[model samples]
Target: MNKLIEQQIETLVEPLVSEKGLELVNVEYVKEGAHWYLRLYIDKEGGVDMDDCTDVSHAVSEMLDTKNPIPQAYMLEVSSPGLERPLKKEEDFKRFQGSLVMVHTLSQFQGFKKFSGTLVGLINDEIVLEYENKRVAIPRDLVKKTHLLLDF
Candidate 1:
């Protein structure tokens, strides 16, 4: 049910987001305690500002009202993906090469499930990373989550 909602929302908002010169990073519909939250993570070449979020929210809200896809009440949030942006697609991996990243695997790799290193991009079906003084190649399928690490 949640997947269906997310797909519907994605289909409905992709065009709107593109029109605003934004990339639709991800869409999530989840329940938190007693409340349901619909979050839209958007991005651009630089970043997103309050005006961008407000515009998207207004546009999406109007579309949702007319379509009425969701039955229950939910809080809709449109915002940037932030500094620790998720690296989900192959393009993302290539684009963010040389950037610092943190990867979590579904199972232990080299006796560890988590690794932080400089992203060396994808080679074949593996994600190459420079960790410590060595290079580690992680199978794409083993990756549970991969995101950029913001160094402050």
Candidate 2:
């Protein structure tokens, strides 16, 4: 996946997503086997249905066609983030506080690269978690991914 392209798509699609009363959860531009894919994960307070995905896909597809940001051919996919929702923004940490989450760091922290615990919150550029009955504060800069850990 190209992070740069994903970032660019996020920048371009966020407003349209917001306009449609949705939160743009995540974006990815990746190659799988012989095909390239651009995926957009969106959400709302009540979660989204297939119709929502199709509507957003059409809107986003038209936008991308107008902009032509990616030079190569790729399939566009729009869908919900699912049960294990990603924590991608500061607000997400605050919103999902007290939820179980798995966070992956760019570098090892306390001899480990991943931490799973209850999300305390993001404070002062650090993500605080209650892991194994202890409070662990991880620098946000080092966090590569953070997502809800489904208890089910």
Winning model by TM-score: 2
Q: Each model's TM-score? A: 0.88, 0.95
lDDT of candidate 2 over 28-95, digit per residue (tens): 89999999999999999989999989999999999999999998999999999999989988889989
RMSD from true fold, candidate 2: 1.2
| Per-residue lDDT of 111 in model 2 | 96
Query: Model 1: number of clashes?
Result: 0
- Per-candidate local distance difference test: 0.93, 0.94
Candidate 2, TM-score vs. the true structure? 0.95
Candidate 2: misplaced stretches above 4 Å?
A: none
List the pairs of residues colliding in candidate 1. Answer: none
| Candidate 1 runs further than 4 Å off | none
